[model samples]
Target: MLKVQEIRELIKLIDQSSIDEFTYESDGTTVSMKKSNTAPQVVREAVINTPVQTTDTKLVKPEPVIEARKEVDMEKENQKTEQENTSISSYDHEIVSPMVGTFYSSPTPESDPFVSIGSNVQKDTIVCIVEAMKLFNEIEAEVSGEIVEILVDNGELVEYGQPLFRVKTK
Candidate 1:
């Protein structure tokens, strides 16, 4: 069995190296680690030999041995499909502004915006401000959910089909 430090070292090694597979075996114990950038990406895996308990020692414990980490060729196709699905779904479901303008994350020059990352909002909640022809337009949320990610920066100029906020489904 490898020590915790050795395992951590192995992880660092794997990260630094471009090689995908590594296996080490000694005596009756066999351990293996692998990395592959295959479709649906199976990135890393580490295996360790389990140790039996002894009455004389309580210092070391065995780690959960990783068996295998390999990319499934079949899932590669599914990954592309999923990407397409997400793109289409995201396109069909966005909070479009009624007019073109400079987008703002806050309600006023000094006031903080109505929403931020991980903020829970309703369908009609105002999320941002759009200044069109010197008029501030409150852009409301069309979907009710938690803000997953912010796509736009503060005081960014927004155009049609430009995403400003990404929301997680309720």
Candidate 2:
């Protein structure tokens, strides 16, 4: 039987890839998963075949608990962004993420961050790292500027083209 964590990992991998369906069967147990582009949902069905009886279980990805937590987190983030936008100037340049990945402020957790608010940066300065598919990509400042805001928290999951930092250009 596959663990819940393992199933969740498989769901994430499939969602990121081009595949839309997957199945696994072994030892009288079968696991099947399907993804629909039109809907943001994943359906998983597990079946246990026994000599005398059969058992079936249906599990959906983004369970209610997870969905509710995500909603709350998004609400808080939206509020924070609204306050931040009030202080952001029209001339500020946004440094955006190049790919979908986990954001890291520092090369290593124990070390200081590559850049912080008020830090002066050159166009080529390393500002942070984005880890995607086991690859650690160094993100550059891309503009000569002073860091005005860090849009994402450390270790947060960021989407492609998401703004990572707000810079006041020189």
Indicate the residue-level lDDT of 102 in model 2.
100
CA lDDT scores, all candidates in order: 0.69, 0.77
- In candidate 1, stretches whose alpha carbon ends up further than 4 angstroms from where it belongs are 1-93
Per-candidate TM-score against the hidden true structure? 0.45, 0.52
User: What would the C-alpha RMSD of candidate 1 be, to one decimal place?
Assistant: 13.7
Clashing pairs in 2: none
Which tens-of-lDDT digit does each residue in 48-89 have in candidate 2? 332332255544333121111111233576788998778675
After superposing candidate 2 on the true structure, give the runs of residues whose Cα lies further than 4 Å from its correct spot: 1-85
lDDT of 1 at 44: 30
Model 2, position 57: C-alpha lDDT score: 54
